[model samples]
Structure formats: C-alpha cells, structure tokens
Target chain A: MHEEDRQLVRTLIRGDAAAFRNFFDDYFPRLFRFILRRVNGDEESARDVVQSALIRAVRKLDTYRGEASLFTWLCQVTRNELADQVAKSVRQETYMRRLVDLEDDPQARGILESIPAGGEAEPESVRQREDLAALVHAALDYLPSKYARVLELKYMEDLSVEGIAEAMGVTAIAVQSLLARARVAFRDVGETLLPSLGGNW
Target chain B: MDTQPDPRADEPPTDDLARLIRRAGRRPQPDPEMHAAVRAAVEREWSAHASHGGRRGAMVLGVAAALAALAIGLSWYSLHPGAPAGSAEVGTFVAARGPVHVAPTDGHEMVVAGSRLNAGSSIETGPAGYALLTVASVAARLGPGSLLKLNRPGHVELVRGRIYADSGSPSAPPDALVIDTAFGQVTHLGTQFQVRVDPEAMSVSVRDGKVLVSQGGGRSITIDRGQGLRVSSDGEVSRLNVAPYGANWAWVSEFSPNFPIDGRPLSAFLSWYARETGLTLVLRRPVTQADLDRPTLSGSITGLSPAQALAAVMATTQFEYDMTVPGELRIESRATRGAN
Candidate 1:
C-alpha cells in the first residue's frame, strides 16, 4: 500500500495532470470531513483549513517518505493547519467551550464510559444518534480508501453485492469479502476513537 | 481459513447498520465554488513544484548558488581586507506595529524590529500596520496599507499607499532617496517629505527643505518646505500650502523609533522630539548651552508618545517647555518660568 502511494506521489511530482486530479479528488473530501468534525461542523472554516493543508502538502510532496499512508499524512497536516487556525481566531470559542464542558460533566463522562465494546446497540437518544453518526464517519475516515469506498457503496448508496462489484470494478465475491473486512475495521476503529470524543462525537 | 467461520455469519443484518452509515455520509460536502477554488490553488502549487522539479531540488539549487557566491565573495574580501563585504541587506526595521511583512525572494514573513531587509525585498503593511526603517541612511516610514519595494540602497518603488522619507539634516550630504510612483519620480534634496498614491492621483508633501518631482515627458516641479503637489491620473497638477506640523503630521509620531535616553544629554532628546514632531526647539535666555548638554537623563521612555515623552523627560530637568506658537517648542529655566 505504501509503495502504491509512493508511486502515485512520484507521478504527482512529475506533473502528471491526471495523477494530480486523482490525488485531490481521492483525499480532499475525506480530509474535509475529518477537519469538519474537529471544527464543530463550521464548514467554511473547515474548507479554509483543508485548502491550506492540501496546498502545503503538495508543496512539500517530495518530503513524503510513505512511512504512513498518504491520507494519514494528509490528516496530520490538516490537524496542524486546524491548530494554527484555532490559535489565530477567536471564533472557535464555542467549539472549545463545549470540549471543556465535556471534560467537566459527569453525565457526559458516563455516556462515554457506557459505550459497549462492540458498538452494536442503538444509541438511547436523538443526540446520541447524531453523535453516533459522527463516530461512524470518523471511523470511515480512518479506513483505507478501498475499504471506505466499498462500505459507502454498500450501505450509503444502498447497492446490492453486484452493484458494489460494478462500482468498484471487482467481482461480487470480492465485494462481499471487502464488506466483511470493512465492517470489522469500522467497529474496531470506532470502539477505539469514540471514547476519546467524551460523548461529543 | 477453513477453521475460521465466516466473519459475516454472526454479523447483524445490514438494515440497521446501513441506516447509520448512510446518516453519517450525509454530512455536508464542499460547495462547488470552494471546491473549484481549492482545486485551482492546489493545481497551481503542484505546477510550481513540478516546474522546479519539486521544492527540494529548487532549495538545493538555491543553496548551492548561495554557497558559490559566498566563496567568491570571501576570496575577494581576503585580497582586499579594507573593502566592505558585498551584502544585499539595505536596512534594519527600527519599529513595526501590526502585521508588517517583508517578502524577499520566497514569500511573505512578518517583520519585527531589527529585521534586516535586502535590496530586492518588498515591504507591505496591513491596514492597521505601520513600520519604520532606516534605508541607505534615510529614515523611511511606511503608513498603513502601503507597499514599498527596495530596488537598491537609495532607490525604491512606491507601489501604493503612503511613505514618508527623511533625508537627515539639511547640512548633511544628500543621499538622494529616489521614489518611483505611477505619476512621476520624486527625489528628495536633503529634506523630509511624504508621497501618497491613491487610485486617482499621487501627492507629494514636503515638511522641510525641498524635493524635485519629475513627471513624465521631462516635466519637473520643485516643491519647497511647507508645500504639497498633487498630480492626477490625467497629468493635471495642483499645489497647496501645507503646515510643517499639526494633525497632518500626527500619525508619523505614533510609531516613532524609540529614543534611547539612558545617560544621553537633554539636548539630544529635544532634538529627536523636534524632528519627530516637525517643531522648532528654542532655548530661552536663562537656559544655557551647558544646561542642555548635561547628561542627566536616566531610565527609559519606551512606549510613550512624543508628547508624553516630552512631558516625562522635561519634568526631570530644570527646564520647562511651552508650545503656545503651534510649530515651536520653547524651553526655559524653571526659575524663569512666567517671567516673560
């Protein structure tokens, strides 16, 4: 996977137009969703931060060593950009205040601690459902692109196995196998990350 | 593989999980305009990097060229020990406020006091920013919303906004600070002057001494002390009488370079105050030259405006000051106060 990402980066640095487009199209939306969650869904601020991160990443493309997947590296860069934006702006106070409140409130702490390991049960309230959605999206963000795409094709697009295979250009059997792996990956990552949100997911 | 039961065999049905996943995916995507703008900016950066074979290569090349130049410069300096090193650095920022930025070859970086500016550098002030630099021995102040480029030691291009230049005392040899603008070129003749550029016109106002404004087609106008000249975009010229001090000159003192008062003579502080405020300094009869030359000042007057510094510094001396005549500050012995 890293070798494939390095090859794509080489093509991008060589000024291949199609490679550049694919790079932006593949990672930009995922990175945007990743940052949007952190910025309390302020879409405009998220867009600005994502744009700055992508521009910086492209400029520093030659420095990418492929030690991590390209999307993970991009997320690191986006986090730095988000941190800079937060420092430079007073507008993130509401988002920051909610995080502080979460740290202090025992009820919020209890909700986070009560989340089951498998994450199979439905959330108890409408608010928890919204938080669950955010956790699911964040989990999808952490997955490999192929896994995330296959899962999205299956669940969000409401595609049958044959439809997922057609969209992914794979066999129906392959789609089923990828779906099985994706579901487990989603559950494992969500279990690890959801608690960190402290009931604000 | 055969021993492991299918992971999906015990998995819950897809109906409920699909709803959750679909709801998560419903978050907002980038708007079309923002997507396009980001794509455009990213592609531009990618092209820049690609054209240079990536920034790493460009940086390596830049370093190599700099090293090669340094080697030659060092060899030349070795043979000529008395000669000055050839450096592009033209000045150091004496004061800066708000978001004053300096861009050399790479990109813009915020400037602070003591920031060295090279000859080819560009200085830009944010809407609330002000900066003071001594370039080529001339005190140059950039007003807010100004962009000035240092072309060489004594020449600059005023791209937009206002810049004030003080070419030291009238008796000193003129370094001839030349400023190029949209309307014409202004070269000061050992004087203090301001050049302002607006969208429709360019104006040059002189506070002391004189400056020669040369317009296109070989037309030239010499503006003396206390005069202002305006040239419209269509080349129409107008003149007006301006005062040497008052509300017009107040902004310059707001970010005036710090005056080090530690162990300095009282006369030196008064000299700085006079130049900064465009006021004449007069010592009354009882205030002897010996009194003015005494090094009695100690401590700091930092972060104080010119008027405040004047009051603070004067309160420590045996002299008092009066500004009853607008452009002149009178100093007299405290013992002789109100005797006139």
Candidate 2:
C-alpha cells in the first residue's frame, strides 16, 4: 500500500496532469463526504474546508513519506483545516450569538414547532435514515479504495456488472468476485464500527 | 478475513444490508463549481512546485538574490561616502489603500502591505490612494494625488501633492526627515509636519515641534508649532496659524497605521489614539495608573479610522472618554463618572 501511494506521490510531484486528475477524482469525493457529515451537511463549509485542505496538501506533497496511506494523510490535513475554520467562526461570535438567541426564543421555538416537516416519512425515521447513510459512508471510507469504489458504482451509480468491470478495468467475473467480498467486508466493518446503525444488517 | 460465501454470492443481495449500501450513495457530494475550483487551485499549486522544484528551493534563490543585492549596495555605499544612499531596502509599507503604486525601477507595481521599499523608489498615489510607510526611523503618510520619490533614508523628494511625516516624539526623535520640493527644501527638527506642493504654491504645516524651510541662497524660515507657511511659485511667502487637530488633518488620521490592540493594555491604546489625533491625553482623577493598565485588549481594529477605532476599543473597557476640551482627550473610569 505504501509503495503504491509512493508511486502516486511521485507522479503528482512530477506534474502529471492526468495523474493529478485521477488522484483528485479518486480522493476528493470521499474526503468531501467525510467532512460533510462532520459539518452537519453544511455543503458550503465542507467545500471550503476540503478545498483549502486539498490545496494545502498539494503544496506540501513532497513531505509525504508514505508512512500512512495518502488518503489518511489527506484526512489529517483536512482535520486541521476544519479545526481552523471552526476557530475562525468561534472568534466571530456575532453570528453565533444570534443563533443562540434564536434557539432561546420561545416564540421562535413555537414557530419552528408549528412548521410541518418535509417529505412523507416521519421526522424521526428521516433522521435515522440520514444517520444510517452517514454511517455507511464513513464505513465505506474505511474500506479499501477498490472495495469502496466498486460498491459505489454498483449501488449508487446503478451500474451493471459489465459497467463496473469497465470502470474498474477488470473482467466481469472479477467484478462479481470483488462485489461479493466488498459486501461481506462492508457488513463486517459496519457491524463492528456502528452496531446501532448496522444492527439489522 | 471470514470469506464465507453464501449461496446468493455474485448476485445483488435483497437484504437490509443492500438497502443501507444504496443509501450511502445518496450521501451529499461536493458542489460541481466548488469541485472545479479546488481542482484548479490544486493544479496551480502543483505546477508552481513542479516548475520551481518546490517552494523551499525558490525561497533559497530569493534569499540568495537579496543577499547579493545587499552586498552590492554595501560596496557602493562604502565607495561613495558623500553620495546619496545606494539602492537598498530603506523602509516597508505599513498600510496602503486604493491604487497606491511604487516605481522601484522603470516600471511601477501595486504596493502591498509589508512590501520593502528601497531607496530611489518613487511612490505615487491615485486619486483615492493613501499610504503609510515607515521609512528608516520616521513614519511617512502620503495622501491622494501625490508623487514622492524616496532619495534615501530620512530624505524624499515631493514632486506634488501632500505628505505627512512624523519623526516620533520630540524628547527622543528618530532621524530627521527632509522633504525637497520645487519651491524650497523643508526639513523637520524632530517634529511632525505636513508638506503640500500645489501647482501654484508649496506649503509646510507643523503639527508639532518646528521645521526649517530653506529657500535657495542661504535664505530660510522657521515654522513653529501650530503654524503653516505657504510659498508661491514666484517665491512669495505667507504664514498662517493652523490648528494641530481638526478636519484639515482628518485624512491623515484616516490612513494612520493600525495599532494592533490584541494583548495590549488600555493605556497603550489611549496613547496611540492621542498621537494619531494630535490630542493631549489626560487621565482624570480617580482613574489611576493601575486602572488604565489593568484591562488587556483582544481582537483587531483594522479598517477603522483612528477616532472610530478608539471608540470601539474604549467601549470594551470600563473607561469613558471626553473630547469636550479643545485638543484634549480626557479619560476617566466609568465608576467615577457614575458617582459624579
């Protein structure tokens, strides 16, 4: 794993544009989802944090020693960026104070309670579903990139077995075998990591 | 790895696990525009590192070039002791506004904060441009529509427009500032003064201390504190009394160097406010030295004029200020005020 990441870092530092695009496409979405969940699905804040982190990572690419996988290192950088963003927001307390005031107001609370929740699903079920979705994404992040990518293509993209094979550059039989292992892996990891969300599975 | 193959292997499982896996796909993704912006920024950084063999190497080259320039400047200065100072860094721009440009060589570049300004550089301010620079030991503030050439440390040529120079306090002044104009040369004697060069006349206003305006042929006139001297194109001179602090000096206060108040005491901020406004700071009775030095400030006061910054900083403390007296800022404890 370290050797593979070392090769990727070398390609990135050599200014291989196509290699950079592949690296970006491979990691950016995963990191984005990782941060989005943590930021309570604030897409703008997540984007800002991830964008700054990725740029910072690229600028400091030569420092990658391959001691950890490239994704893990990127996550470390993203965490720092997120921490800085949180600090800046805390320092600008006017907005935070307004939010606190709104939360404290009984009239505002009454108005919020009066508004009907969206969608046909009950609010609790919707929240549970959202939490389960976030947990699944987190579990996928922990999986090997190949396992995560294959699963995403099959389920989220609704890609056929042949399509998954084409995307992964493998034979259909290999795709099928990977999918079987990926599913088992996902279930095992999810059950271990989040029993509440993965209890039924 | 428990690779337990079920009978339903290689097929889509119609179990709760499959539903959850599909739900993960619905997780929020990044916005397309934001994604593209990030990619562009990353690629740009990668290209910079690739082309320059990393920023560290580029920084080394920058430092090496700066050292070589310094060496050449030192050699030139040593060879000609009586000549103007060699082309070396003499000051740094502390603050700038609007379209301030510094022509260090033949071409001009937009001035940025903390940029080193070398000797022989010409600074020009646009109609809305205002700049505050610390040249050597003096702080020079250039107003809009001005063109000033830095000859050397403590000396500058004012081609046109207005410039204010503060050589610090009279008790312990820095290097005296000399402003050469078309009419005559105005040199400060450890003072704070404003020099304005118009098409028809050049005027020197002394806000503090005194300055000597020298016409050619050994003729000179001393302008005392609170006095202004205007010399016409034909060498006609007129003197007038000008207030040290008023609307006339408001523009100078607008572009004053920002006093970083974080972790600084209230007394330090008050002193800065007094100096910037040319007002005498007076702590009224009951406001002891300990009271003024007790509270430490936090946060920034950037982008505010001197007066506005003072008000904002004072509001965070238990002190109240009164500017009712002309050219005096009286500060007292709020508790003292309430008791009175």
| Best prediction by DockQ | 1
Per-residue CA lDDT of model 1 for B1-340, tens digit only, reads 1223345823544555566677776645665446545766776677667743432210000001111211111000001011123547767666555434454423213334565666766676544456778777788898866888878777888887788888778754564578999899998788888888765578888999999899878999999999999887778899979888875576677666667899999999998899998999988887877889985699888767788889999998888999998899999988888565
TM-scores for all candidates: the values are 0.49, 0.46
Spell out the clash pairs found in candidate 1. none
lDDT of 1 by residue, A1-201 (tens): 599889989988886644565577568878998998887676777888999999899989999999998988899999998888778647467557757777778997897767665445535555577777777877787887778887787767777777765444344566677788887787677668776544331
- The clash tally of candidate 1 reads 0
lDDT of 1: 0.71
Q: Please give, for residues B1-340, the per-residue lDDT of candidate 2 as tens digits.
A: 2223344445655567677787656655665446555655665666667533322210000001111211111000001011133457667766655434454432212334566667766666544456678766778999876888878777789988788988777753533678899999998787888988866678888889899999999999999899999887877899989888875576687577767899999889888888888899888997887889889999887667777788899899998999999999999889889898
Off by over 4 Å in 1: A1-201, B1-92, B105-116, B338-340
TM-score attained by model 2? 0.46
Instruction: Give the alpha-carbon lDDT of every model.
Output: 0.71, 0.72
Note the DockQ of each predicted structure.
0.17, 0.16
- Candidate achieving the largest TM-score: 1
Predicted complex 1: CAPRI docking category:
incorrect
